[model samples]
Target: MMLMAAVLQAAVVQPAPGMLVERRLAEAIPLAVGDTVRVRALAGSAQPRPFVVAGVFEREADPNRIARNDYEVRLHLPDLEALLPTHDRVDRFAIVLAPGARADPAARWIESVAFGTRAYGSAALAEETSATFRVVSRFHDAIGIVTILASAIFLLCVMVIRVDERKRDMGTLRLIGVSRGTVFRAVVLEAIGIAVVGSVAGAGLGVVVTRIVNAHYARVYDTTLRFALVTPRIVLIAALLGLALGTIAGVLAAWRLVRVAPQKLGER
Candidate 1:
């Protein structure tokens, strides 16, 4: 929970660079340290002077966890004061409280003293955002469960059909002295192969699709909304699910084969 701030001191005082910019802003403008950047003033405002790029900072953790405006820029007090129509007016101020201090009482006191002041609690905002994420996560989980179940059912059906088609071949092998255990193992191995290949391909395709979507959103909205994150844990889960599905399908197919006698199968 490191807090970052940009401070402006006397012009004579030398600081690390001049102004600090967020990583995302730097990327958008492609600015480097020592580069001079000029910002155009909004309507009815005087023109802004150029400021040197001091440093670029990035959010150490996920941006969603922090309450910040990525597009906001911080400048030295002197620099900002020079740009403002008024010499010493500020839009807002940030106050950091000591650890374990209650913010409500302080906020109330501040509001009472200041006219038209609004106090917002960061904790409340964080809690609300977390709740929203939880709901969305549950929806995604429900969709994933439905998808997996549907895939399992489809795989089971396909394997059953494939086994039926191979009944004559299986009967010929059994007639030639192939053991039931060997036939079962062969069918199970084939199912496992198909599942493994399908799982790898599917996972790869998902990663590519997610990357593309994220890229599009970044370009359009200037935000990083990675709906799908490909990690080791995710890969492991996908692999395990695939193996489980394959095992279940293989067992069902083998069980059906065992129910029919080899002689009967050959007759059909």
Candidate 2:
């Protein structure tokens, strides 16, 4: 009753026999205002009945909703009553309270008055439904941690190989009275530059992959919901992590090269 009251508040319908089609249904059937369409209940032996398209309505957008859009249509109370064998009973409905009203207490009150009804706050319903999405997020976090470890190891190995190649040059600089501190700073800066370049390339590759994956899944699933999200913050954080790993790798590589005696650098 309360739900119906809310809908009736904004609904300006004539006493004529017609039904409102959801935007998705309207577009799918190529229906226009005043077009007549046959509707039938999914269950029972009810035969199809013709109804004029009174209006079209788009469902409110919910970005976080994982479910696909519903092609629901609404009819007037009396029309619905004739179509459904519901017998003046509604199976489910939601209630909106006044502003600043307490949900827990209102839910309790509603349950008390409405026997055989279970009323829970919207927060509870949202949490219950979003549980799977939360699990997927944790899985992504685990993969990220493993990726970071692998990246650190690979960066270290590359830096060690690079420093080994430059051993002769480092030894020559040391012989020319170049201080170890200046030599260390040079190697560190080179590593940082490599990291910056790699990070930018990786970000670009990620964007391309995201587009491909999203487009492929959209075709497969026939849904408009996004399967992945890549934000600027995520990219920035990855770049910073790369820089930190580069700095650490540079320090270790520089230390290995500088600790060797300048005269012995020519030896394998």
lDDT of 2 by residue, 118-223 (tens): 8867888788777877998899999999999998888889888998898888889999999989888988888888878889998999999998988997676455
Candidate 2 to truth, TM: 0.80
**After superposing candidate 2, which stretches have Cα over 4 Å from the reference?**
1-16, 22-24, 56-70, 76-78
Scanning candidate 2 in windows of ten residues, the lowest lDDT window is 61-70
**By lDDT, who's the top model here?**
2
Which residue pairs in model 1 clash with each other? Answer: none
What's the lDDT for all of these models?
Answer: 0.79, 0.82
Residue-wise C-alpha lDDT for candidate 1, range 57-137, written one tens digit per residue: 764445474345446567778777766677765666778899999999999987897788866687775676587678888
- Candidate 1, residue 157: Cα displacement in angstroms equals 1.4
Q: How much is 250 displaced in model 2, in angstroms?
A: 1.8
Q: What residue pairs clash in candidate 2, if any at all? A: none
**Could you tell me every candidate's TM-score relative to the true structure?**
0.63, 0.80
